[model samples]
Target: MDGFDETFDWVVVGSGAGSMTSALVMRQAGKSVLVLEKTGYVGGTTAKSGGVIWVPNNPLMRQAGEQDSTEAGIAYLEALAENLPGSTPEKRRAYVVESQKMIDFLLAQGIPLARGADFWPDYYDEVPGGCKTSRTVTARYFNKAELGPEWAARLRPGFVSQPAMLSEGLKLAWVGRSWKIKLLLLRIGLRVIAGKLTGKQWVSAGAALQGRLLKAVLDAGADVRIDSPVRELVIADGRVAGVIAESGGERRRIGARLGVLINAGGFAQNQAMRDRFMPGTRAEWSNTPEGDTGDMHAEMERIGAALGQMDQMVGYQMTRMPGWEQAFVKPPAQSLTGKPGAILVDQSGQRYMNEGGSYELYCQTMFERNRTVPAIPSWAIFDARFAQSYPIAGVRMAKMHQVWKDSGYLKEADTIEGLAAQIGVPAEALQATIARWNGFVDAGHDADFGRGARAYDQWLGDPFLKPNPALARIDQAPFYAVDVVPGDVSTYGGAVTDARARVLRPDGSVIDGLYACGVSSASVMGGVYVGAGASIGPSLAFGYVAARHAAGLDNSL
Candidate 1:
């Protein structure tokens, strides 16, 4: 590293939502900001996401005549942070309260945000103070022409990246909604034609979210160095004053006048960290970017930055095809498990949970099951009929039997017993689990687990199908089985911070000139997934706070 006297008012590590948003805010405040990214491009997991930011009571919701009160949102937050040691009322209140103001600042910088959906329910709609809508916000489809091809090509894709509206993509993904899908496709076609005529491509979801942040940073003249990673934070006079960054295998010392904000994401890619902090996680099943090694967490911890929430992660049981690496290759685990005709079972071939639960519950259950039994990598067993209705890992495009067999990811047999033997589970037990599931399907109720009892689960499945679309029989021949692992959306555990986004020590002392956000910091929800966009939304809010505080500006906004 060479410390050739490069300095800035603020230095931020990582190029994810938290880091980028913080940089944008500081730059907009007329402060020189330097963004250091480990990867060759910008945007981390935020790019490969739905980009929904949960703003409890933004103006967009009010304009639509549906505004959730701060009191209600705070009530929800209080319930969420109940048992969480690191989740404080101050942090939760800070997020839900300043959400609108932080959004206003970003919107002024041309963030292109809008209310995510009129009905994108909180993941925990059943939780107290939770609302069906008026809490989620995201970047609407934005023209990539603003970034041009250079930066545009660097934008990563996750889930849906075609720049269509989030609502439209949700409709298209719902295979059962044929008419709605057609309408959305027609609208998309028109947009594509219009984009072609105007010489532009579009990005949406996570890509758009991070893209907008990056654009704001660039437009405000902030310096962002790609392929440069901060290996260590520089402490000067008991304060974080600079960072040692690596660029092209050479080290450079960049000084920060204000502080060092670490938004480098979590340790989802770090197996040793996973084994140490999050034993329930597996490196292969992670959905975060490969660059997310959680190295910064340990680095900060060595400097006395207290770590908490090490036991929390957000994930869904997911499938991996022959070439697919991350579990996010298909519809999320909730969609797969909640749908009818599939039963998730442990090594003993016994059903473990209500298949119609949310993704967060899936991770929590997998962790609990692994405690008593070897259930980290479970199996999803179904029949040919299920394949006809829904395809696992997009198997419909290829020959399901041949491709899955060749890949060794899918086991198929003419009978349940044979399938069980192929997968190496108890034959009788497998057969019994399926039989019980079928009985529940026929009875039009999940007698044992109540799979389709929740409105959320039912909404994910085909509403018009039979008694309960999430309950179906697996009696058809050519039954299939695939391994489903506890794949995380991201690790939600790490260095602890306060509502002002200031890092804390074990002795309850603030680490001056140091801050953290995103999964790099312990979540405000205390590792709980309250709804879609929970992580991204709070990341931006606190990152914004970290920037304002570092810049000596009023954080009350």
Candidate 2:
């Protein structure tokens, strides 16, 4: 403390969902809090994401008349985390118990949160103790103008920036088919017009959630700074005491009397770290913001924090498009390939894994398939019927950009064989694969991989399709193809923390006064994603745990 330029009761690094939650917790405890963000924006990758928080037994669910219990939630997590390296029994129980408390705290502080769609089933709804009715939560739409100009401009944008809620936005894909969806679009359009007239900038999804959290943190009088990156963690008396960081082109040593919490995200933007930990993936394919470069990861490792699950990522399949490097949201192919009348095949025109399932498992399968075959860039083959009925990469098939074909991102042909030839796959093999898929459609069941067998898989499929929503004949003419890569939402790896969110050493001893959450720590859900917002829910929960621990408060409301 003698050499420190400034001091605070708690110092939090990286302004993602967890960072904001921890800051609010400390502030509520009457402790001085400082939140440092590496990027100019206050929200990290959370801002660009869907911002769904998968909290089991949350108040929103209870209020909605959905039945859930802490024991049931723990059972589901145990099933998912069984034999996984990054999770422990204590951590799993703590996540289920503390998640509701965290949400309650947010509500008490007046954060606008509500339950997501009841139809949005858990990714593994068929698993024991899984809530098929859904346990996801999201923030209500927020007007950025509420944050004032400076803060509003600094809030990172989400993929879906419209004023509509996420539940309404999901129906957008079926707008062409449903009159209900068309009317919903009209409502959203009117909402946007109203915002424009009132000089209000409304944002939805992740941006909306982060905006509400940021507003609360600012209102609580927490000192928040951007463009301030922590370079090193300073240790005193064999514990973390402060951080050496840079701000306004000046280096400063800031001490945390209680502790320093790192929620700075993972190395999804760091190619070197990806090559070292996850070898089969490319950093460019990740949708995480550039600030996810793992600077704090290296710093934490230098301080003897044990890193685990470096090989895992929140896999989100995508197809590259024109200007993809600068695109706000990468062209998602997760739902596209799983929709009716579409199927994914390897380079040899062979169908491997089930085309419909969790996107995390989908990309994991891509890497796994690549180990034995050329599946890194698989082919998503679809027919004209699908083209006319659905959208690809946010553009309807009839209105696909010319640059898509010019850039070799899209391939079209009058026949299945012709499309296969164009994509450099064996025509005969492609034809046989399509024939087999069509047979499955006729029989109303997938014998090979059980495509629509699960509730989650059907949710990813076309809801309008009959029999099996995930299965359809791919026999129509004018077939098309696009290259699908194992893109990622964020890398799922980092310093291992205990149940209390304390960074731990390799020997299972805690790094005194040091905490980590979000992507900065190994995922609490292990390698499997149980539902949407699994990452965000644990992040906020652990962040709350970290702050309460730092403030010498117990885990109670």
Best by TM-score: 2
Clashing pairs in 2: none
Worst 10 residues of 2 by lDDT: 77-86
Give the Cα-based TM-score of candidate 1 against the true structure.
Answer: 0.92
- Candidate 1 residues 1-557, lDDT tens each? 13436888899898888788788878777899999888876899888878888887787787789957888888887776654545888778888987777888888777778888787666666778878654788888876678877887776665664759786776675545578678778889888888888887787888888888887788889888888978888888888889989999999888998898999998888899989977757877778887899889989998999998887887767776666663454334566666778889988889988876668778788779888987867888878888777757544624656776887877889998898898788999988888888788888888887777666666666666767757778899888888777777788887888888899998879999999998898888876787778888888888889998888787563
Query: Which run of 10 residues does model 1 get worst, by summed lDDT?
Result: 325-334
Off by over 4 Å in 2: 555-557
Q: Superposing all C-alpha atoms, what RMSD in Å does each candidate have to the true structure?
A: 2.7, 1.4
lDDT of 1 at 187: 80
lDDT of candidate 2? 0.90
TM-score per candidate, chains pooled: 0.92, 0.98
lDDT of 2 by residue, 1-557 (tens): 78899999999999999999999999999999999998899899999999999988899988988889888898898877754445888888889999999999999999988887878888888787888778999999999999999999999988776788998998888888899999999999999998899988889899999999999999999999999999999999999999988999999999999999999999999999998999978988889998999999899999899999989999999987677777777789987888988999999999998877788889999999998989979999998888888788677766664677888888999988789889999999999999999998899888999889888889889888887789889877888999899989998889999889999999999899899999999998888988999889889999999999889898443
